[model samples]
Target: MHMIQVVFMTVMVFFVIVTIHEWGHFYFAKRAGILVREFAIGFGPKLFSIKRGETRYTLRLVPAGGFVRMAGEDPELVEVQTGQTVAVRVKDGVVTRIYLDRLDERSNVVRGEVETIDIERKLKLALNADGVIESFDIHPQALMISKGKETQIAPLDRQFGSKTVGQRALAIVAGPVMNFILAFALFAAYFQMAGVPMENPDKLLIGDIVAGMPASKADIKVGDVIDSINGIKIGADSEKMIGIISKSVNVPLTFTVIRDGKPLTSKITPKKDPDTGVGKLGISAAIPSRPVSFGETFTYAGKAMKNMTILIFGGFKKILIGDFKMDDLGGPLRTAQVTSQIAEQGFTQLTSWVAVLSLYLGIFNLLPVPALDGSRLLFLGLEAVRGRPVDPNRESMVHFIGFAMLMLLMLAVTYNDILRLVRGEH
Candidate 1:
């Protein structure tokens, strides 16, 4: 039962995070006047779809991938009717699509066979090497049965290629930007709901007493709020209290603690911790918690986001330098398993993990790998430098190769995940 909950929570997190990432592209693409034909969550055959404005929003069969299809992003392929072949001829910047099939004059439509029939749609067709149209798809509104007429799906300006480099860059960068924003917002909200820690300046509230430690030996117990240490008033500064204890290491000090509204004094010697080289209290104090102030909440959230980003980059650096084991890398399976475990802990734990995962994803997408936002931005950089775009064919090939490599890597990591699971290594 717990395992099932973990898996469900993990999958839900992925869905929400990926949706937000894709929404970033959709939002900016629309803002840049680019035609987004489809905005889909997941891949393969769609489970459900709805067309609104110019875009078809879809939920697909596979949760591993999602995409935003823009006009001119991929070469368009035209479907041929049964027993029909499509041929295109370009003359003086006009493209003509001729269907070799029988035509019925009475219906003014292509019907059964007639020697060599030409059902002509005369418009501009950009042909690729395969002789299929390089661009354009049939639009429902522009459906035409009339002979020698052209049908247009997208206008020239609405196409992705028609956008300026700056506009395109903005659209490409938006995905990563949105991911970071979501992480920061979630972190802020979590802090606001869970409350923030505020150290008590006037006293130290003992939260835990370590077994066989100096404080425990001295009869110090949990909830013994210390009002003073070594005759010095224990103020709001925890560091100062620690400093006093550190200086008095191996020496006896007087402690004034409040226990259930009663003041009690005791003498104990501070001992040095061999492992940490710090004065040992054998007792842990809990900071007081309070609701976050409006301004401070965001500050805490921003710091959390920043620290997580640094941690991700640091870990990546270590992995690159061989400081981390390759087997330690967790793919989707491990992510799901870990997410499930975190979910079992509580809502706060799961939410914090989501924020951390969001930051990780945002940073990962920004790595300059092909088929990623970072790589696209790199291509834009080349375009900016040369004052023109790179050949689309070459760009497409690079992305294809990159995507293939990524899929293979995911497979390998997934295999590792399964192996670990079988061994009960989670």
Candidate 2:
């Protein structure tokens, strides 16, 4: 049951985050008059679908990733060639529907062989009907029918590439921007609920004690102000006390604390952390906090967002400089595992975790790597600088190669995650 809950929550979280990211692109594309063909969640075989306006919304089998498909973005053209037979539904000399499949005979449906066609630019078609060549203008809202399914045709004006570079850049970058917005909102919500931490660097007061740790075993409690350790007058310096404790791992140290106007002494030994090799007393510094005002809540949330961004970038810098191991990286599997653990901690912790994940997603997408939003913006920047776009075929090939490499990297990290799980390592 616990595993099931974790799986469900993980799916829900992915759904919400991906939906928001794709919706950002979809919304801006529509506003820029680009025809958004589909707004799909997940990839692979479609499980559910519905058409609204010009866009088809779909849920696919895979939950790992999703995309907002814009017309003209795909390299392959869905076009009718010369000498192909097709059925058309015309209204007042305008072709409103073009069917690529055989349809039941009807007075409104005309059968013809295509002689010349331009559905994208000119929106016109010339066909030979019983040796008589006829030309007809296509309606702006013309539909293409294939396998009995209708999809509106996109003219040149409605294609993504037809838009200005500024519009295209905005549509591309909107996905990552929406992610940052979501992170900010989540952080604000969490701050409103839990209040921001107010820490004092001068005092060596014990605010919280971990269960079964050295301090707890030594009978030290929260609200106890530590006076000194090992005959050293700490003198309100928490860092000095921490230094003393960390250097004395597994070594007994005398701790004197003032509790309720009485000084008491206890001998505690710091335990070594397996991961960081740091000594731990399993106690946190005492900090006082209160609920923030409505305006202050946003201020605190903004600060939190800034701090998280810096931390994420710093971690990336360490990885780039070879200061961090590749095994430290986590993929989707590790994310699910961590999500399960945090969910068990309670709703507040889960909320904070989600906020952090959202922020990471936003920042990662903004990196200047191929097949990502940042790379698309880079191409647009070059286009603006050169006064012309790069060759579409070349650009498409670059993205395809980049995408393949990313998939391989994902598999590698996922394998590492599985190995860690098998070895009983978190």
Candidate 3:
């Protein structure tokens, strides 16, 4: 049952995040007149799918991630291009063999592998019965053979590589842009429902308590309104009360609380924190909630989003600088565990977690790593500077290598997560 809950939470979070991310790419690709072949949520075998217009939307079994399949995105021949000679061998008005030929600089014939096919087409060849020297017209819908297989050569404009750098960049960047927008919207709704923090802490009620800290050790609950501290009266001026508590760092302070209107007292000592060299109780007073104006709600949401973005960026920098511990990194299992905990905390906490995760995912994909949006943007940048796209085969190989490395990294992280779980460490 516990495992089911964790799995459910993980699926819910991933479905929203991955679907939105893929939708971002799909929307922009459509907007740019690019062909999107598939927009799928999840991975592995398909559970169900539906086609709308040019795109097929699918729901797959694996809930870990999703993807958008764009036509000509991979290095493959999708259609036949114009001005290319195609040879067709016909029998009973049906093509039995097709061959594609290109001319070298010296006008020598460079024939590709032959392919047998069945089609009906008439070619006006400049050849005798010996069937030696001949030329043919390059026609659309004409039978074409490539590497002993019948395939359509993609039209130039239909290919992603044929798009202008700006268009390509727009499509690549859209996924992350939509993710940020999702974070903003989630934060906005959360702020509106829960109310943003006040400029001043308005009450002496405890809003947050750090576990294994002084307050938690004293059995202080979040909603317990503080009546007094160390025989000093607690007032609405939270700063003054905090100052008094801070001053009594090493000394035991008597906290008078009103739980359900019944007064109780508890003595606890605030220790000096090693990191900050400051007296701390590891508790934050609640800020009184009030209805916020529309403008204020958006303002608060935007600020929250910006702060989370900065936090993620700072954490990433710390990782790069070796400031973060190896144990700090987590994989899917850990995420699911955290998700379950946050869900139990209530909707506000869960939504906040979602927003943060979405923001992180967005930023992560924007990194200039191969097989990510940032790498594609880098390629587009190169194309913009070079006045031509990178060779499709080479680009594909680079992404393939990067993708394999990512898989290995995922496996390593997952193994670490399992070890931590076995040791009962979250």
Candidate 4:
């Protein structure tokens, strides 16, 4: 089912992406002799964990977030965990698990349920305070576990200080690079296995024609169904549709199409988007062919990867410079949709997305955003430039501000995504 594909793609994207990003930090941190504590996937209460090396690599209950925790250091990435009830106690930097039924609390019965009456709330309720404040919908079941961390979250070590600026920057930049590497490999492997997508003819179908664009201007309407171009019939023997268009660039070409019970002629000139150097008439193209070429496959794959990277880069730039709106931002839902589409289109398409996505992952991480590997590296660069460590306090402050801003931006994009979903805008 298309829906199933979407769900699968979404999971694949997250796992692949998250692993690469975190691995960047993990690898470099280990190399830099930092005391890494936790390498976790997903955020929230840990559903499970494995203690390995000097770290607890965790798989948390919340699939939405994950992070690597370093001893004496706060991560730019935060792990948010969810749990029904986890009874754990910390003492002398040791964490020991305990059962929750053994704990006691003063209870007041209300509506056939036991609850602890909030003394402050009772006062406020007695005053007939009305507002969201007056509505005390406390979940006593979700009690805050008071046990302190048994392990001391140490400040990032002076050993981190001992590393050359380049090393520190590498440690910071590696996470994003890992994401990109993962993406490219994933993409290339798929391409190698499934074969490069050749521009096929018999399977070609147009889904959309841009309004007022060359295609529409030539009366090439949707459902017109193209059969040939420039008297070269399109069918089983048709090869190089792109080549044909490239040859016809800036020159009018006739399109033979079937409309209703009659054949029609529509003439359009292929024009270049200039920026991409691709032939276009604003027509959407798709095919049903599965072609495999053992020879030159890598060459074709490499070319596709390059194109994907270019497109992704341009898209990211648009977003950065405000040419793209926040509503265009994708969160989990959109990712799921894309994953499904990619999977349905076949592994080759999916792989292509992976490569493109990987490049995106790599480049985006390079951004100088706090809590991001790139931002950390940027600060390290500033330190190196000054020939001294920037004041740690100021560094911390800037990162903190960056982190807050990043969170806010994420919230905004997520909100936009939800709004679009509500409007059934996909």
Superior by TM-score: candidate 1 or candidate 4: 1
Clashing residue pairs in all predictions, respectively, total 4, 0, 7, 14
Give the per-residue lDDT digits (tens) of candidate 1, residues 9-123: 8788998888898899999999998878889988779899888876888999866668899877886334334435334333333333333322333332222321232222322
| Order of quality (TM-score) | 2, 3, 1, 4
User: Higher TM-score: candidate 2 or 4?
Assistant: 2
After superposition, which runs of candidate 1 have C-alpha atoms over 4 Å from their true positions?
1-7, 44-50, 79-152, 201-288
Off by over 4 Å in 4: 2-6, 44-47, 60-65, 75-148, 152-159, 197-233, 236-298
Please identify which of the two predictions, 2 or 4, would achieve the higher lDDT against the true structure: 2
- The digit string of per-residue lDDT tens for model 2 on 340-389 reads 87765456667788888888887888888888888888999999999999
Q: Which candidate, 2 or 3, has the higher TM-score? A: 2
- The digit string of per-residue lDDT tens for model 3 on 1-426 reads 265665677678888988889888888777776767689987789999887765678999856667888767774443333433454554444333346643232122323222221221332233222445434433423335565544443345545666778887888888888889998888888887788665665456777787667888886787788778877787677777778777776888888878988988898888888886666888888766777889987898888988888889999899789997768888777887788877765677778889898888899999988988899889888988998888988888888898888777777788899999999886
Distance from true position, residue 131, model 1, in Å? 26
User: Per-residue CA lDDT of candidate 4, range 1-426, in tens?
Assistant: 367665777677777777778888888878877766688988768878887645778887645545766543443212212322223333332222222332344132111111222311221111111211112332211122233332322223423655678877777777777876676576657766765444644545554566546886776555455578888776543345566876666888887776675878877888876887766777765443355565555566567667777887788789778997667788655665566666665665677676666677677767777766677788888888889988787787888898788767766767777888799776
Worst 10 residues of 2 by lDDT: 196-205
Q: Give the TM-score of candidate 2.
A: 0.81
lDDT of each: 0.74, 0.85, 0.73, 0.61
Clashes of 3: 7
lDDT, model 2 = 0.85
- TM-score of model 4 relative to the true fold? 0.60
